[model samples]
Target: MKTQRGDIPRRLDTPDPAIRFYLFHGADEASSRSHATRLLKAFGAAKDAMEGGAIKSDPAKLADEANALSMFGGAKAIWIEPAADEIVAGVEALLEAPGAEHPTIAIAGALRKTSKLLKATEASPHALAHISYAPEGREYENIIEQLCREHGLAPAPGVVSRIAGMTANNRELARQEVEKYALYLGSGESDPVPLEDDVVDRLGAGTGDVAFFGLGDRAMVGDIAAVQEGVDAMSANGSEAITILRAMQRRIVMLAPMQARVAAGEPASAVISSMGRALFWKDKPVVTEMLMRWSAPRLARLGERITDLERRMMFTQLPAKSAIGEELLAVARIAQSARRR
Candidate 1:
């Protein structure tokens, strides 16, 4: 059976007994692995329950391992990550095996639309296939809210959006930020306090992937030196140029509404504080400064430009890294000009 991303959570938590295999593939490898882990937990399977292997190494061994009884006779599961075409025969063997009780999950990287392995898994009566993608807009916000709930947190009005803003392009970073926030909040025995804007500023600061490289913070503040440092770190760390651009795009999206509010004559501080309901407290001063430097009209233009840049990055064969670097430098120049004005 085929499952959509939205339905995967519910299905995993209440896994269908009929589904014996799952094929997870997408550009978002982190989400695929994380979802597979959730499914295993839901099925009362431990980490030890999974037999891990590579598709290129021993596709046939996958079935043998899954079929082989554990010393403790625990529930069986198989995890194959970064899979390739070599594993199709092994997967087929597992599918054809009689009385197979194990649940096998394959987490593959970017697959073609007509992937044979994916098609076969989805077509099977006892299997499921789900494609994970980077969440966008409200989808990521919902994920942030869900993460809060899991940690027994009741987020204050903009907390979810704030967290989502920080981690939109990266799932692994989102998980870590949410976990860190939950830990700060302590256990659920007592009535948990609603997450506050200042709390996010203090606790969630510098926790995101880009934040770790100091890119987002510097970009928002118009610090040329910091921006250069961030870009250098990104290249050194092998972060994709498109990924960095997407993060900047998300940052621009977050700024548009706040800029609109500021344009409407609300004090920059107040507008930023309200719209920044989830903004890190320490970062508030910087965001406020940026808001003051640019008018709503200018910010709106930048927003449009960012969208255009992201589209180009996604669609065109324009040297992505170079394009991203030029665009970022343009942004810094705008900030510098705004400062002069």
Candidate 2:
């Protein structure tokens, strides 16, 4: 059955001998990696299994390896690392088959809410859990609270909101920011450490600046010349195309929720404050205007286009600069579209 990320801790404790296949799918690699590690530990090394690549291309080998007799027995756990579409199809077949020996765990880099794999996993008789790194609704705030609690501290008033705003649904990054603050405060402090604006600034600098801020500043202001120049500079600096697309995708994804929050009569300060202290005062106007200009549907479409471009880059032997230029054109179009709308 389908389960939420929060429910994962409880499910891991269950004593069921039935093979459990967990599909940890999310945009955040850190969260996915962490979940995979937890699964490996719980099932024990004996019965634990891990695989990678396209499933269909080598189904026989995958099946053989996954179904291999457990070294120590007890409960078996099979983990399939991030794979191509073909491999995902093979996994779907395995999930459909009757009487599999061991519980299979298939991890996806990202899965859509309505994906067939997600649906099958949810419908399967076997145990299925989905851990999404996408922070939706109250999840962002919840994560901040959880992080504070874990560090044995309470976030000062508005601190949680501030951190959430800066991170913008990037759970792994948010966690890192909180951990940084926690460390800065040192262990076993007498009282809860209140985050100051400077703390956020330091964290942002350490994390290579707000990537979106750099991209959006050029893109939103209709500075095509500057955008091209900046892109060239970034390429010259040896930044990967995938990294650029991923950052753009993240910012676009964040804008919708942010826009919605703003429309709901939330104060600009409150809405912006929800973002961690990492955001600079200079970024506010550009980001805010871009949010207004780009509708949610448009941003979602742009994100999908970027995903396709990234996939092509990964699977094919295309020249990185050309492929990246194509992706940048798409970003430019989004900016133009935002202006027209």
Candidate 3:
């Protein structure tokens, strides 16, 4: 019968003994794959993966695989990707096989509402079907939080939003990020420490998708040598100076609120924790140092400066590499001199 997305996880984790066939299809293939993965993990049995095309070509093969026993004596679960109406006859054959013991999980793309496979799966008492749709707003946040819990992730505020935004709300990607947190924290299906924003900032950001990470971070923290090194490297690669400024601009925007909190008498750690979780263990000393050094007024001024630079750099025909590097160097030097005094 048709199933709800929220209930599908329960069904996969502890499958109903009466049901042997599982069908998942929808516009969100990522969600479908995630469900299929959950079922496989729950089963922990050997897989007997068969393509939907192969089943469509030989309808009897589906039944043959399902009814057959493994020589090694471990249960064999069938896997079908791109399950479609063309496999209807094969699925029907599997349904008809009285001796079918192995569970079959099928992943399909968006299926037409009138698709015969959809109807057959829904109508069969021995079979189950679920449709996945892209989650919107709070729904996406809720899903991310659930995944985090399963993986022993105790997310701080904004952690879920960052993951959801970074993964573009894809369940599989979100699951991966949460799993990473669990791994890093050594949390194995157990209570985990609050997941912090600094940890995600250092770990997440779309898997190397953000090329601007280092440039801005180095410039803002008054790492004069590092800033110059980063700029020189970018210039060597012919990377636009605007890209560097934009990355720094983002960092400044994120830091502005924390700076305000710090200015209001809260410790940097407290401010950071309020935003999310703390930095990972190994990076604590260095991050704490940076936190102490980041002045509210200076960070605010840098934000303004970087914003204007980014806007002006957009249409400039001049080579901006030297100009941008010099600007960052000035910010770093000022920070350095202020600290020295």
Best by TM-score: 1
| TM values, all candidates | 0.80, 0.56, 0.60
- Candidate 3 stretches greater than 4 Å from native: 188-191, 208-341
Off by over 4 Å in 1: 48-58, 194-208, 212-214, 235-237, 240-243, 261-270, 273-281, 292-323, 338-341
> Can you give the lDDT of residue 333 in candidate 1?
70
The lDDT-based order of candidates, best leading, equals 3, 1, 2
What digit string (tens of lDDT, one per residue) describes model 2 on residues 236-330?
43334554555565566657788677667675556666775444565567666676566666667766877787677654666766667655655
lDDT, model 1, position 219: 60
Compose the digit string of candidate 1's lDDT tens values, residues 96-198.
7664567777788777767778877877877888988878777777777777777778888767766766665567677888788778878362566577776
In the range 1-341, model 3's lDDT, one tens digit per residue, is: 88876687799899887888999888678888888888888888787788988988899999898878886898779998878898999999888778577899999877878999999999998899998876645687898888887877889866776666566546787788888877777775656677887788778854332344456556556788898776766645334464456445545555666667777888877765564332334434434455667777777777788767754554354457777888889877776666621
Clashing pairs in 2: 54-87, 55-87, 161-274, 162-275, 162-276, 163-276, 165-274, 165-275, 166-275, 166-276
Evaluate model 2: give its TM-score.
0.56
The worst-scoring run of ten residues by lDDT in candidate 1 lies at: 47-56
Top candidate on lDDT is 3
